[model samples]
Target: MSHAPTGARRREIWLLVATFLVAVAGLIYELIAATLSSYLLGDSVRQFSLVIGVFLSAMGVGAYLSRFVGEALRGFIWAQILLGILGGFLAPVVFYAYAWTGAVELPLFGLLIAVGILSGMEIPLIARVLKEIGAPEFRFENVLSVDYVGALAASVAFPLLIVPQLGLMSASLVFGALNLAVAGLSLWLFRSDATRSQWGVWALALLLTGAGLVQSERLVTVAEAALYEDDIILSETTPYQQITVTRFRDRVRLFLDHSIQFDSFDEYRYHEMLVHPAMSHASRRADVLILGGGDGMAAREVLRWADVAQVTLVDLDPRVTGLFQSHDDLAALNDNALRDPRVRVLNQDAWQFVEHANTQFDVVIVDLPDPKNLALSKLYSRAFYSLLMERLSPRGVMVTQAGSPFYARQAFWSVVQTVAAARNPVQVGAGPWTLPYHTYVPSFGDWGFVMAAPFAPKTGDLAVPPGLQYLTPAIWQQSHVFGADTGPIEADVNRLQSHALVGYYLDGWAKWFE
Candidate 1:
């Protein structure tokens, strides 16, 4: 039989609840700091690693400092109030710092340490509070076990619920409010032990966090204005990525995860360079397949060909495909290519689509972003190339947008080498199995492309489609001749297991930024 609840037992239960809520709040702050840093700066691996390292070390500092507190209950309550204020305002402060000043790493690591130290104080103080209320019934082990469970729960909810629903700024404020509530509950439970000073701090924390929750959207807008040069017309955070479109007069720019996808002014040159070479080289223009041109610019170029019958475009993000399909301003840029009856859009991962596609295509265009991270690096691997080669018809030709050869020479060469290695055998009327070509775009300088076919066409065999803004027949032939700085040299093939392109890409680009 269960006994009726006593005041002591109920106070202990409330203490345990406070422990869980504090743990969740602490972890959410850490994640928000790490994610925001990664978004603003490239190289997610470096940002997360450094942020976690600084955070954990500062936590150790907080733990050591906790030994000095004489009044355990008062110390714990005050720590909660301080942590609530710090973690609540962290995202907005960091974003404002980034916008006004170029120094992000300094403030980013500083806040990580501050929050980590305060959060570190929390678990130890809560453990002490539990002991003060009830001696042997609530052991140190029980408090620690509850703390760990809360952390695990927070980690799961961060990506699945918190980030998807509240986003980075608002999520921080909500969790901050929760932290302040824990402090309030602790003061109420231990009213006999609390002083007026502690109550005052809790009230101040409550007011600040309330203001943060209300002003989060305004803060996001101001930060965005500083980050982007053009006026931002549309911005949305999808489950997959951050999609932002900015407009500067007549020119429109699309940014995905803060990386530039295309600028409308010069996109014709990039798209024409991507689509025309393969379409002209292919024996048949019918049944064309595009791997990652979700923007519909590549499809727009492909449709210009008179002989083309059906165009299948596969892209991972439905948000991107849907926007390009519907939005009038964006649709006008792609010439309403996605809505065209001849084109079929499949919102799926390119890697999975290639693996599952049984049909063959006469022309294939790969217009994916640069492989700066692991997820994108996989798209450039030899395994992906092998899968892509499987879908090419006997007389088919393929083209892929290799990044700037001048800036990322080794990475550019790696793409060219990987495509050739994937198609190593089966020589069919060859002058060269793979041809590397590049054209200058005003937006992105010295961009490269690799045109591969089962049978190599002659030097002047490829023809540019009519009604093109860039790439005439003569200009197409001239694009193959790259200057000394931009021309390729020897590089290792990018394999799935090794992921050589990611390293090469980082090494090549990091120097430019420095």
Candidate 2:
């Protein structure tokens, strides 16, 4: 029943389409800024909150400034062009800023404000253009609805498709090109409204974005090399995190989201100290459970024991396990432990796996990262420890890698106290006796671990494992002694409700690093 659209009607439809495209582009830029800041800097909560706050406030500034524009069509086109250029190169710019200057706060926030202001001007100018074309009175409402829908589309696509498929740097460039394309389409639709100079500017911006897209990989490599001292032999942006491996001569290092996990030169000290203590303490070592050791280093130490029949390793990221399992150099580092017949690797969330687990282990080793954020904080909570205790055999022993005893004193003791506080309802009495210990590794100074069990773990006359790079009988006994400065302080029990551990960990590390 619908008739062919008139010239004015067609112009209004095109303006609405431009409105949708602009909305999508704007939201994508905001997400990219927030995500990139979080990756470069730790404490994701703080980075995301500040970036969103600054961007939104600047958007308000842009909306207020839009009232001064006399020519709606020209203003909208200019905003689109500027936003495309700024947002297109945002990731690389921020990355280089962090690499070269060793700080990113100034440039990151400056570009965020500029892009927000331009995005804020877009919808208002589009509405004005729709009115100028003699569209319906309800056209403003239609513009708002379309804008909202486009925003939803962007939010869903960002994590599911954009980040995983194209990555942050390439995604930004792609969305930027889409923004410029919208401007070009508007110019062609209303050819009389745009000048020859406007077309020329648009063409130049498009060319620049295309060139950046073609060289995105090289740009990432150069920026990453500047950040690290060693040569970056492997780098991949997985769905979960950025996994980078660097090598200097014979020494190799693994970094997850810019945080150094381990340095090959001194990694033996960390791994031997982590695995052997609990393995020797456990009454039975036949069935061992490791929560987070995807690199296979922990499994290598576990396999050192002759009595251990099966070692079950559960890690969240498949890319990490696959790398250790397949890569020649990485696999050799773990002695190909992950490919052994006795070891079973399951890629699943540690908390979820323990909650659903029905098997009881003779020894449980939790090798998770520090609880700097809410997601990681829960893994160290009293609730998680309680679930883990239920999975431990009566004579079983459990040990977790606490933070640095010297730098994060309270955080280290918090894990020790939290483990002592966990009460397994099925087990009798009020004790999950804890043993706190620390050893000095040159790569990471004064690292700590906490061992807990239904009964007191045997700390004396331990059977030390042979062929160990570190952790001798004398060093193992000495690790239990803490100096005055590194000794425990009063720390609140870490629970899910308050997440006290995250606050303690962040505040402790911030004092030293910031």
Candidate 3:
């Protein structure tokens, strides 16, 4: 017959399990806090660095303070209960504070310190408990080894499974439950060792964690409500980015990963300039390709020409394309361009789409976001432009949204230089004529665009369509001129390996913050 394990063996098993559980739970909380901070504030590097620094310092403080506690087992149990309660509710509280008071740093850092201190004490107490119970193999080294393994698992699970499946708000509560589970199991196993106060704290922690689990979804909605200015119509977290649509009166806005993509009120100025400049100069507008214009605003501008036979739009996010396709207000804003018979939407990465494209386009509009990160920097690289050049018709035109020349002059010039470096197609030997232009949009001031064509383009050749709300022939030509402040500066070509453009973009925009 199988017999119950001896107390020593049981203690060894529970302590090891506790070490692993606490390690995973602790790192998950740290990641969630850092991610939320990055989303709310700009610059991922800065936010993550600060969160990790504060967490590790607090952990050191906790470890040092653990020497004062008399009972190791009691200390471990209380630490687990406190960690579970505070860490589980952290995300929701941070969000609520931001929404109600526009204060996030204090509450965020306060919770991180609390969770870190409690987590730091967990492994030390577990090691002490096992040694006291006469476990021969219970050493600090063994405890630390198991803790590191748990950390590796948590790092993998965070982005791949936790954030995508459970989201930041709910994931915290789930991990918090794991923390409480460790404490509850320890309480059951060591019932003879527990004091009255430890039992009461454990009960209260269970009640609080259970409530968080049940109300997780509602709590997430309430927290997210504060992040947007208008009423959120829909929000989805995809592997690539966070997609949010908000509506205020007749105006609608789309935000990708918490950065504003567009606001309906003044988007026409941006879209009109992006499209008409290239469309008007191109020899034929019949076949058009649009990369990264998921909202369909650019397509709407291209579709104005009755002669344009087909418009193929490639955007990375299906969530973005699907939202515009289904929403009545969003559809109407784009003149139902996504649903147009002549327009075909492909939900795929723009880089992959361009590299393998079998068809040639008379006009290609590159309306991608600014090169703020590595993934986006590749799109602005010379390699991407070279591949794009091969797909253009003999006399075709291409235009890219180069960002605010006034704010990011070096980045804007880098794009202009990259397009020119792509060189003119052999079929049309006259030039790889590059035209840099900027227009004032109230939402985004002094935005820039670079238009490149196989043959030299003339302002006189532009056949601008009638009824455009923003773009006039006079203003179209005038956009080529720039004020002294927004003028071009020399910049290195953005190669995939170097990724120098992201640095330039960051440096250029950093001044605004200062």
Candidate 4:
């Protein structure tokens, strides 16, 4: 039979628990900083790398500074309190900095480094305190093991529970509260070690973070409102992305991860141009597949053809498709296309869907976003297009929305080159003729598209249906013409192995935006 632990052993156990909690909180702050930066700044790879580098280096700095500490208990408690306040408020501060100033590098990285330093000092101070308290079996390895376990828990929970449930802003505050609670636990465990002033500071920090937690929704709204020009009517933090809808006067706009998807006023121009080109060129519009366009705008145009028998739209995000399908206002924008009897919506990744699809499509329309990251870059790759070629019928045609020809010249041409490079799996040595075109849309300037087929698509006799706001026969012919400056440049074919399109896209846009 085992007896209860002695008071001395109990104190050591509690201190080790405190070390574990500190590790959890510290890593939570690091992930929050990295995710928040990625959402605001774009280029997730660069943002995460930079944040991790700075945070780990700052941790080293904090460890080096721990050697000069006089009172281990007081120093540990102070670090917890300070870390709680800073890490808890990190998201809101960074959000506001980006929203108001149109810049975020300084405050985001500054807070990241500060939080890292405090987190770094935690384990060393805990070990020192255990030694001071005369822990019977105060092995440094035990404390380090607990700390590592805590870090693992935090890493797993952050993406699965914290981010999906609490979101970045609320997660920050919730973790901040947890840190203060840990500090309070330490004070209670050793009442004589902490002064009245330390307790007072901890109480104040708790109050601030608690209030922030309660009002985190309002805080997010206010911060997000400052980022856009119009009043936001709907906002949702989906597990996949931040979905926001804003309205000004009669114009409604959609934004995914702070990037404008479409402005209702001129969306017809984009949607019409995106959908009608391939639809008009295809010999049989009986079966169609749309890779993106979760808003159902592309489906709206496809339904214009009475010859279209079935339309299958595969999008990655259900929130986007569901909103466009159910929301009264958003549904009307798509003319209830997603709800039409002939349309089938499958919320699945386009790449995976194409690879496994057994049925062939008469017209394949790729209305996906630009190749901003590696995930998106694959959709524009030669391998992806090759897979798509297998899904295209013998006389079928496919069209993809390339990025802006004026701004991202190489990225635009890369799509064309990639599509042209795709070999038809069904017909060996068959020509996958490609046509590159561009048209002006007010919302997205100089937008481009590339259409490919096993045979040379007859553009001269396009059976363009009536009622199009843009893309008339004359306009369609004009879109094929590019100015000397906007003309295609030599570009590497985008492949899954290299993901060259993402680099070209990021580099091209950065020059204009930065």
Candidate 5:
């Protein structure tokens, strides 16, 4: 009849706090699982297939097992114990298993299922625990609200707090320890549910697994290193995406989504072909818009003209832009192009930037990576070209890094055809000079760009700029020559699944590797 004492009221608040903690642990498990999958498998398709497959399979099993759980909170306690043990070890185990067995897809799928199934039991079990502890008036909606709020907190912290500070390996253990804390809370609150001996063994298991995972950071790094053949010089994971640089002897390669963007070793071969032909014809007037060469090497070339008033570059990655802006070694490579007061670096995606530009340029250099997949394919699409064409001044030329004429013939022409389809009647050309270094994984070869404009592009000798070590007229001249073996093949530029071009890219790489 009377209100409960203050001590009794405090106990209910603690139970609600316990509910929040367990919900957070479950979400942390999902995030780490999904993130690792995305890293190991490139974004386009591998991650979705693996993560979704595992979660759905595990959900089915969780639903199946839920029917068998006993009346006591003991089942829920045991579930957290199992979840903590599995999820704690999940990151390091998945990484090492993939490296050892070479069946990345297998464990990648398996662990996701395990985490998902365990996570599914959490809500029902926690609700059951609250009810058994004499909190029957706690409405379903109230408990659900607590669960959902806890999820929101976990979502915010996992990326900003967990990943950046703790990193993937340590973060997994930290979350595992958090899950153990929830289990420990249940043990203290409900000693009557399980025997003392059983609780002791479960606690030992949880402690051993959590402590064991503390050393997991070393294994994850070693496993990742084993995945790549080259020496990984730098790897950064931004909230947006992954940026990796790998070096093999003389070659320093930049990779985004496991697709090679440029080899510092052979970038000149690609950049010279991309710039010189248009640079000479377009240089006389001096207006330039470069889309997506965040490395600044292209800016190094575009800024050479004394007549050029301004060079505006649009790249999506701020870190890349900032690196060249401040990092001394990189600045030297790009001739400090980002610092050139004449050059303006706009940190934005090329697609959105090109679509919305109000002004036109004497030259629009579309320096985006190849459209090996749909995300990049959009940049090469007819719609994107139309926007680009809209922003080109008369006599203004825009060049794209067309797949490859040698192997990705269809893909190379699809760029040509799409530009043609893009209402610009674009003229296409090929240079096979960069074919020697095609084993960069997921992509192949330094290639060509379709030169699209309102009129035929003027062909002339390359004018070597001062302060340059790589570009010359002779290299420019030879860039146009395609040999008999690696010359044009029947292909079309990629359009969604008409990935006739991706096939060509893959084929070119296969031959180059062979």
Candidate 6:
């Protein structure tokens, strides 16, 4: 039944190998574009959702254009070459474009469409080449299946191998060369095609460029120097998060997406705001729970109160706590906070930890991040508040960093409402001044807090820990009122999964680069 000969089988195997490379190129380009966007932008889920939407739409447009593809082999060769050039340079183009283009997005949508169309058209062209060379009709589905298998390989390899090993720039270039290799193979297989010589030049350029980048790893760091102002002291991409520690002498800073988690110089303001108020208001305080201060700033604050018999701090990232434990500069910031004798550090997601908390606290301080996406927003959800309520002793106080009451006003109140609805007496508070720290970061400004309880305080007249540089009675008093910086807006519709901060962050921050 099969018309194809053994010699043809050998030739077809080589062509399939070429198709495998093409598939790898397409997938890496798709994932790299999505990955870079997720890295630069704060929310991975939102960035990836938009990227997949745009890419799929563009791929549909591309597939429709395949009907007009007349010179099949020539067009396919040119496509591979172009993909090599464009995909290889995409990372740098975006990085530099962020600095150069004062406004208007890097036409990432347009690039997505261009690359997606080209990528979508790849399989059809491969099938056409195979059919022209006397391959049996039964082989069509098998060829397509092989193409998808290669794509799966690329997907598994990109995040796990390529990215961590090569980083953005080098990885792009290496994958670009892979595209060029596909072009060269296409030329060898289909030498009669008009695009052969052009493919040669593209292949040479891609190989040389990729090999050059392999040697210039240090230059890559130097190039990244422009994006960050301070010296790049520590940079790592952990499974949970990207952590960057930078320093300007005593002013070491930990940044999660351009948002300051802590600055060695002045984090006392943030920690004091997060911990002391709730602890001071606690009724006969003895036990304490801190939800998310992996850097151990709040733990240091909690340990100061002599009545606190045990302080349990739950944070998601071990690397964060590890740094506070091991990194010299980090330990100095919190004054060896996590190492303190009374503290028990549980490195786990507070969302999961609170579910299993058998022990209640006199004071529960929620030092969670602002709800940027669904995963984070749920921590601000009514369900999570119910858990918090379960973990608080009767007549105890819980406080949280409710974000900027001005910029994310409704987002801040959403936390309060979620808590209030959870059968807790949610007492709201406000204060605004992180100054130039949060000012440059999107539309973010004017930070605040929320205090909630099942009943009134038992230790309302408690003493302050001696080392506090901020969180005085006056600052605590000012932190309670909602004065203009943008009064509360649309609290009810601020769903956790839908994530209101997504809109606010994009709008407010998108202006700065422009």
Candidate that beats the other on TM-score, 5 or 6, i.e. the better one: 6
Prediction-by-prediction clash tally = 0, 0, 0, 0, 4, 4
lDDT of 1 by residue, 437-474 (tens): 99899888888999887776655565776788888877
- The Cα error of candidate 1 at residue 494, in Å, is 2.0
With candidate 2 superimposed using the best TM-score fit, by how many Å does residue 43's alpha carbon deviate from the native? 1.8
Q: How many pairs of residues collide in model 4?
A: 0
Q: Which stretches of candidate 1 lie over 4 Å from their true place?
A: 1-4, 423-432
- Score every model by TM-score: 0.92, 0.95, 0.85, 0.95, 0.82, 0.85
State residue 394's C-alpha deviation in candidate 2, in Å: 1.5
lDDT of each: 0.85, 0.90, 0.86, 0.90, 0.69, 0.71
Tens digits of per-residue lDDT for model 6, 307-357: 888888888888788998788778877889888878888889888889987
Candidate with top lDDT is 4
Off by over 4 Å in 6: 1-7, 100-104, 189-196, 215-220, 284-287, 341-347, 425-445, 486-490, 493-514
Residue pairs of candidate 1 with colliding backbone atoms: none
Native-vs-model 2 lDDT?
Answer: 0.90
Writing each residue's lDDT as its tens digit, candidate 3 over 1-514 gives: 8688887788788889888889999999999899878776645666889999999999998898888878999899889888888998888888789778877799999999999888878777787788788897557898999999999999999988998898877888888888889888898899898888878887888888788779887776776676777988887777667788888998888888777888898999999999998988887889999999999999999999988999999998887888788888788989999999999999999999999999999999999987887778899988998788888997889999999998888989998888888845654454477899999998788899998887776557457788888888788878989889888788998998888888889898887853
TM-score, structure 4 vs. true:
0.95
Q: After superposition, how far is residue 169 of candidate 6 from its true place, in Å?
A: 3.1
**Candidate 4 structure quality by residue, lDDT tens digits, 325-356:** 99998999999999999999999999989999
